[model samples]
Target: MQRRGFLKLGVGAAVVIGVAGAGVALIKPGLVDGKLGPGARDVMRAAAQAVLYDLLPPPGAARDAALALQLDRLDAFIASLPAPTRKELSDALGLLATAAGRFALVGLSRPWAEATVYEVHEALNAMRVSTSNTRQQIYHALRDLNVVAFFNSPDNWRSVGYPGPVQIP
Candidate 1:
C-alpha cells in the first residue's frame, strides 16, 4: 500500500477500535466500576489459557486452581494500575468479550467461554501476525498481562524452571 493509504488504514483502525471500546464499555460493561467482573474474567481466562497453555497444568483440579490463582493475581495487578491504564485494560477485555469485537479483532467467531484452547491460540496467533498494528498491540496487551499475572507468583516459578530470584547480600 502507498504511504498515505497505509496511514489512512492505521488511523481508521484506531478510530474503529476506540469507538468499539467505548460502545462495548457502555453497553455490556465487562468491568463493573473498573473491576474485572464475570465477563472480564471470562475473557482473561480464555486468553490466559491460550497464551500459557504449555505452562499451565493439564486439565484437572490442579489446572483449575492454577487458573484461579492467575486470575486473582491479574485482578490485584489491575487494581494497582493507574486509572487510565486500568481503563484501557478494561476496555480491551470488554471488547474481547463482545461477539462482534471478538470476530473482528481477534478473528474468533465463537464465544470466549466456548472456545477451546487451540481455537483461542489460533486467534491470538492471528492477531500477533496481523498487518494492523492495533491488532498486534492488542495481542501483546493480552498475552503480556497473562504472562505477568502467571509469573508474578513465586509458586509458579518452578513450573517455568525458574529457581526464584538470585539472592543478593
Candidate 2:
C-alpha cells in the first residue's frame, strides 16, 4: 500500500511539473523554439554553395590560373597552421567543399531560412579551430557569406537592409 501510494505521488508530481513547464512555455513566447526541417537543410547547403561560387572570380581564359593561385594560397596557409589545428581546419574546409560540390550538382528547391542557419553555425563551431585569426576569419566568412548569399538575393533583399534603386524613367 505504501509503495503504491509513493508511486502515485511521484507520478502526480511529474505530471504537475510537466504541465507547469508547458504552461511556462506557452506564457513565454520565446522560451521555446523549433528546429529546421530537412527541406531547410537542403536550401541552406544550396545557398552556401551559390554564395561561394558567386564570390569566386569569374571563369574565363584565366580560369586555370585563378584556381591555381587560390589553391596555392590556401595550401600555404594550411601548411603554416599547427599540425592538429591544420587537420581540423582541413576537415572543416573539406566538409564545406563537399557540401558546395553537392549543391552544384542539384540546386535547392527552396530558399535558405534562419532556423536552418543555426545548424550551420552549430556545425562550424564543432568542426575545428586553429588560430584566433583563423576562427575569426572563418566565422566572418561563413556569417557574411551566408547572409549575402541567402538574405541579399533579390527575393530577400528587403529583409536584409538593401534599398533598391529609385530610378526615374
Candidate 3:
C-alpha cells in the first residue's frame, strides 16, 4: 500500500477510462453501453453535498435550494442512465421518500427529519457496497434527494416562510 502504488492505480484507472471512451466511439451502441455521464455525476455530487448541509436541525435554505436544482438536473440525467441502473436508483429513492412521507404524515418533524436523513444515507451505503458502476451517481442522488425531502418538509417550510415563489406568467 505504498503511496506510489496507489497513485499508479489511479493513473491506470484513468487510462482505462480513456481507452473505454475511445472504444465507445469506435464501437456501435449495440455492442456495449455505459449510460452515466460526467454532467450527471457532477449534479449528483453537488446534490449530495447540499443534502448534507440541509440535514442540520435549523436547515439550510441556500443549500436546500441548490440541492433542489441539482435534483432537477438529476431527473434528466436519470433518463439517460441504463434502464436497470435507473430502476435501482429509483427504488432506493422511493424508499427514502416513502419513509419521509410517512414521517411527515405524523407531523413528527424531528423523527421525520431523522428518518429521511438516514434513509438516504443508507441508500448511499448500499450503493457503495454494491458493484454498480453508478455508485457515485447514486451517492449523489441520495444526497440531493435527502435535501429535497428536508427543505420541502412542512417544518422547514414553516420555519423559512417559503411561500411558493410567485408565478411569472
Candidate 4:
C-alpha cells in the first residue's frame, strides 16, 4: 500500500478504537440494563431518607411504603430521562455506591446504606456547602429528586396543605 494511504488507514483505526473505548466506559456496572443496580438503589434510598427525613411520615410501615413508592417513581423518572442525563445520574449513583467514593465525596468512610441519618445529613450538608461545583451539583440533583418524588404524591398533599386539582364545572 502507498505510504500516505497506510497513514490514513492507521489514523482511522485509532479513531475507531478510541470511540469504542469511550462507549464501553459509558456502560458502567452501576446501571444494569439501563436501570439502577442494587448498590445505586440503596444509595438513593439512603439519600432520600436523609434529605427528606422531616417531610417523610414517621418510621413504620407507612413510611416504608411511602419511601418505596417514591423510589419507584424516581426510578421511572430516571428511566425516562435522555440517555446522557441518565448516564450522568448513573455515574453519580455508582460513585455513591462505593466506600472510597463516599469518603471522597462526603468525607465518610462507610457505605451510604450503613451511615446514620445524622451522618448522611452531615454529608449532604457538606456537599451542599462544598466549594466544588460537582459536589453541589450532586447534592442538588439528589435533593431535587427526593423532594419532587415525595411531594408530587397525592398521599403527601395533606402534609403541605395542597388540595387536589380543581373540579370541572
Candidate 5:
C-alpha cells in the first residue's frame, strides 16, 4: 500500500481498532464494574518505570515497593475523580491494557509487563510526539498521573527533598 494522507490514516486506524476491540472484549482486561483492575495496574506499573525514571529508586526491592505504592496512590487518585471522569479514564486505561492498543496506540510490541524501561520510554516518546491529539493526551495523562502518584508517596518525599507539610496549628 502507498503512503496515505491523514484522513485515510485515521479511517484505517479506526477500522483496525474496531476489529481489535472486538477481540479484546472477549478477554476482559483492565477496568471492570467501574473499578481499576489488575490489567490497569500492569499498564501503570510499566508506565511508571518510564515516566518516573529519574525519581524512581534503582531497580531492586525498593523500586518494586515504590512502584506498588505508586499504583496504590494512582488508584486512590483516580477513584476521587467524578464518575464521568473515572469512566473515561477507565475506558482509556482499558484500551491501553489491551495488546492491540499497546501495539497500535503505544507502539510497544512487547507486553507491558515484559517491556523494559527503555522500550516504555521510547514508546511514550512516540506518543508524545504523535500528530494525534488523543495520543498526546494519553502520553500527558500517563506521565502526569505517574508523577502525581509517585510523588504522593511519603516514602518518596525524600527523593525530592520534601519534608512533609509544615504544621500551621
Candidate 6:
C-alpha cells in the first residue's frame, strides 16, 4: 500500500479499536447502574466506617442511617465522574473487595467487610503514605468522599457546629 494509504488505514483501525473499547466499558454492569456493585459497595462502606470512625455515630439506628446516607452520596459522586474516572474507581473498588487485592493493597488477607477497624485504619494509613501516587490518590479520594458526604448532611452539621446557611430575606 502507498505510505499515505497505510497511515490512513492505521488511523482508521485505531479509531475502531478505541470505539469498541469504550463501548465495552460503557456496558459494564456498574456503569449501567451508575453505582458500584454489591461487593464494591460493601468495601466502600467498610472503608468509610473505618475512616470516619470518630465522626460516625455509634453502631445502631443513627449510625446505620448515616451510613446509608453517605453511601447514597458516594454513589452519586461516583456517578457524576467522567466515564474514565468512574471506570477507574470501579476497578479500584472491585480490587479492594477481593482477598488478594486486600493483601496486596492493604496488607490484609481478609475481605474488607471482615477487616477490623484497626486493620482498616492501618490499610488506609499505608495507602495514604504509600510511595505510589495511585495508592495515595485512592486513599485521599475515599477519605474525602466519606467526609464530604457525611458533613454535607444537615443532620450532622450540629456535630460540626455548622449552622444552616443564613437565609437572606
Q: Report the number of the highest-lDDT candidate.
A: 1
**Candidate lDDT (C-alpha), each:** 0.85, 0.41, 0.47, 0.78, 0.83, 0.74
TM-score of each: 0.86, 0.29, 0.31, 0.77, 0.83, 0.74
lDDT of 5 at 14: 95
Model 6, runs deviating above 4 Å: 1-32, 167-169
By lDDT, the candidates rank as: 1, 5, 4, 6, 3, 2
Question: What is the TM-score of candidate 6?
Answer: 0.74
Query: Over the stretch 24-104, how does candidate 3's per-residue lDDT look in tens digits?
Result: 423322112233233333324433553554443344776567555555544545556687766555444332233232222
Worst 10 residues of 3 by lDDT: 99-108
Worst 10 residues of 4 by lDDT: 20-29
Instruction: List clashing residue pairs in candidate 3.
Output: none
| Structural RMSD, model 3 | 14.0
Using lDDT as the measure, name the better of candidate 2 and candidate 6. 6
Candidate 1, 20-39: lDDT as tens digits: 76797667666676568888
Model 1: which ten-residue window has the lowest total lDDT? 26-35
Clashes of each: 0, 0, 0, 0, 0, 0
Indicate whether candidate 2 or candidate 4 has the larger lDDT.
Answer: 4
Point to the candidate with the largest TM-score.
Answer: 1
Global CA lDDT of candidate 2, please? Answer: 0.41
Q: Could you tell me how far off, in angstroms, the CA of residue 78 lies in candidate 6 after the best superposition?
A: 1.9
Q: By TM-score, how accurate is candidate 3?
A: 0.31
Superior candidate under lDDT, 3 versus 5: 5
Clashes of 2: 0
What TM-score number comes out for model 1?
0.86
Q: Give a tens-digit lDDT track for model 5, residues 57-134.
A: 899998999888888788888877798787667777878888878887899989999999999999999999999898
**Which regions of candidate 4 deviate over 4 angstroms?**
1-28, 167-169
For candidate 5, the C-alpha RMSD (Å) to the true structure equals 3.0
